[model samples]
Target: MPASTPVAHSKTAALARVLDAIPKGYCRYTQGNVSASKAESLARKFHLRYGIGCTPAQRVTRRKRGMANALLVMYWPEGCQQVEWLMLATDGQGMDGEKLLDIADKPGMAWLGYELVRRPDRGRTAWTWRRPASEMAEHYALIAEFGNKHHTNSLGSLLQRLANQPGFHGVREQSKRLFEEARRRGHAGDLPHLFYVQKVSHGEWLRLG
Candidate 1:
């Protein structure tokens, strides 16, 4: 399908199936050829969406990698140069890598994007992933704030701690405190613009705008 065409629900489902069949390993799996064409289409859509030139050679390479990456790198074609999107597989072993397939067709999951997901095994490791850290120090500083708070309760507790800090009368105060905290922790940017402040029974609660 052309890049301009609206993606259909059925097509998305098919893409999900294709993604599901992809084996997560260093060695190539022959079984995936059944969906090679569809997988190639999905890959083209992905690279094209990002303005990556899709030459026949690059196309073949991407097709192989799409069907294969612990760390797949794509260098832009000449005159179409751009920063590469790093496709890092979380696991060197295939066990955790298989979890990536689960991201397919889920709500809030991008078809061609990496995501964070808990493994189904007893350990429940975070098999999915996040975007690469920003090169900008300021942007990375904000990301540092909640980088380790993956659990809902842990995150809520952190927020509650911030809310309970003294001298906070409202959401603005809370947000300002957050900015100050980020800055204190090495955020080099200006006060971040927060768009919302929610009020609770006890006091004003900070909600990211």
Candidate 2:
């Protein structure tokens, strides 16, 4: 399916589709807007990958119960790529956006390419978080190490440290520009969240909350 296409006919269906699409064993279903039977019915009618009925609330709870080495998906209609959306989703789900951002910011996951995508079918207008799993195998060791280092798992804190590292100034500048643009576009919040940052051989790239 096209990345932008809505996977289901309704918001509940859309959420269920996402829950099913997540790699098996990583999540379990809980009731939300859609009942268990309804979720299963929609999944079957839509031929979704997983026929689990779950809500964003349930998904958040399940995520917290497991390890912190997973991607977070946020849905918003305003089309903001700023940290505000991350924070809002985290607050709604009862998970920590900073921690999830830390996992996504790892050097090994850089290839996953953090970006916001618009999903029109789900709600006429909505954006979903995306990190393609194209190179997960190559970064398994680094990701595992990251999982082991729970003490250093805050994206904001990590970014502060990276700011002191050589050659990270440009990255910080770019992030500032993005934040400013988001603010100008009315997407700014009281505090910002760090989303993803990558340091390649040539330069660094960053996405802020």
Candidate 3:
């Protein structure tokens, strides 16, 4: 399939086809909108290698659970920008959150601005999408725009509210632009991936059925 193709079909199917088109034994992951079923389905579709454990449901980071929908990973050697898109199918907020912060501590994953709602029994941070400021309006504009205010540090919030996706909010696109520029200047800071939820019918995404 062409890079510019809209991929209007199921993301899992489309990603499977794309993976098959690549070299054998390639690794991949999915997050947010890209459910576990999608990841497993696509992995099996291409017969590529996948992880060996299930410590965290869907292989998503434990810190980002509930905060994210899902994550996909496709690792390739450096100097392959086109592969960036394929790898994007499984995004990670810098495997090293502290390191990512050392690099870009803008918002979203870092300084989340929201509220806390719950009794002593149990409670968690909460954040909603915002319009976003110029400091945070670039590649994300293609998906959604923050409302100028956001708050949440929960895993679900990170994935559903923070990670990049169509109609999503709270991403600093300018930071993304900078991320891209860094990559262009031989400074690819971190791997960028797509995110999605499980309700979209990913279908047994975590297993190689």
Candidate 4:
């Protein structure tokens, strides 16, 4: 479909429609070529509506990992040609916590994972980070604040903000580590604006450079 085409419903509705259209047991992979083909089709539909690319090359199922479930690999494109993976549940339901952790623990791909569930009744989608909420309360707050201000909740945006806050030396360091890891994983993005710590009589603050 043309990217400019007006979707009949919101993006979330489109996602729900795509997922709901999948045949029962299609996620099992045991359904054979029919299932695989349907998955690819649905993935493409999702990509068109959401601007997140999903192709046959990026598809991975539980069978591939020796697990007894299904997974959807969705990629979010970044400004600097970087793409991050989000392993979503194939059944339209939220993913299991243990299952998500198991996938994260594996040595292959590093993903910024989340459980996205389509709420047909609510006419939207709900998102929950795979990590524990308590462990990331502060980061979540920061992300929410940034999203509220800039209308985006992308990790890159949060990292950019952190990189500009000199008072957050630890966060800045963590951002560097994430950037390096992203680069190592072939997910390099445009460099965020640089900032420096400036000293004053009252206290220290961030000074954009």
Candidate 5:
């Protein structure tokens, strides 16, 4: 049969067979030629869609220190340069001692760029991850007022306790003081946003919101 045969086997069936042959627990198993081929195909697809370049190198190096090189295809607007997009994609550990941000600020590149950020590391603590400490304080006050007024409980006390989790003990911590302030000046409405900005877990705050 010719390589382009459409008689006995359909393209969908052939693709399904390939997928089915992929062993269970792939993460534990080492990636083989199958993975590299797939990576190259993805690279080509990304090139076509995003007007970026793809390397035919077919050398998808796997897991350098438990983190693999992810092949990402990005589609930016018209006039976006391919090299600029590549630089943005290859950031941090993939960085090759070059100044990425400075390169991005150059004339042709800056026009084609926007900020890129990774998802917040889930392992970080609330206090550590909270943006703008003052905003967090305001949110603390809001949650506290809501709990005291409607729920007849002050989340401020709970959050205050969390802030002093390792250092302070008992209700004598700063959480108690925060609650006192929230109770003294009352607040309410839109509990989720308050929780999003502070010590409360998104899951719990989302339910209450």
Candidate 6:
């Protein structure tokens, strides 16, 4: 969970460029290898909090999904950085401990490491994982119902106007009402709750889950 660690050598220009290309608040880069045990321990720090109507197994499954996606960016001596390992589990990424150790054993290979990190921003605009298929279907059904109810104002026209307006105050108010309606209809689940009303296209403002 450490965002950074001190290393004696300065970052090479290539490494700096790689770091710049990576989006902020996603991962942190360091100049050394981390033990598997250490990486797992770091991954353990992320826990899924239980919520109303959520089961313990669901929480565990989601946590495992997140940990499996935690990638380690490795820079080999060949001057290339690639996702060489998963922080917690290796099965999905086609990597294992022995393979990593063998690569480290090679001589004259420079290595840089990067691991996923938690973001401090709590903004609603942040990207999120998609919801379950059943839940998404409910949202789409609701959208269709709303379109039928408000035939005078086409959904595409409303979305286009929202796109033109800064912050889209009018559409945002509509989104808030729809979210409340979804919750009332038991469409929104308790865990992994939907927060943002994202704009997927000029003609659509939807929670893309």
lDDT top scorer: 4
Higher-lDDT candidate of 3 and 4: 4
lDDT of 1 by residue, 183-203 (tens): 455544344344332322221
**Superposed model 3: Cα runs more than 4 Å off:** 1-105, 109-124, 128-131, 135-198, 201-209
Residue pairs clashing in model 4 are none
lDDT scores for all predictions?
0.33, 0.31, 0.30, 0.34, 0.29, 0.31
Q: List runs of model 2 lying over 4 Å from the truth.
A: 1-122, 126-129, 135-141, 149-192, 195-209
Clashes of each: 2, 2, 46, 0, 1, 0
Predicted candidate 6 versus true structure: per-residue lDDT over 65-86, tens digit per residue: 6522222332222322322222
Root-mean-square deviation of Cα positions for candidate 4 versus the true structure, in angstroms: 19.0
Q: Per-residue alpha-carbon lDDT of model 2 for 1-209, expressed as tens digits?
A: 11112222222233333333333333322222334334324334322222122344544565576522222222222332221111111112433322433222324212113332334544564333333344223233333444355423433343344333222223344445434433343332342544332322211111111
User: Regarding lDDT, does 2 or 4 come out ahead?
Assistant: 4
TM-score of 4: 0.22
Query: Which candidate has the highest TM-score of all?
Result: 4
Give the clashing residue pairs of candidate 6, or none: none
For model 5, the superposed segments whose C-alpha errors exceed 4 Å read: 1-88, 91-135, 147-150, 153-209
Over 54-122, each residue of candidate 3 has an lDDT whose tens digit, in order, gives 234444553364221222333222233222213222223333221112111233321112111112223
Error of 4 at 30 (Å): 62
lDDT of 5 at 104: 21
Model with the higher lDDT, candidate 5 or 6? 6
> What RMSD value applies to candidate 3?
17.7
User: All candidates: CA RMSD in angstroms?
Assistant: 17.6, 19.7, 17.7, 19.0, 17.7, 20.8
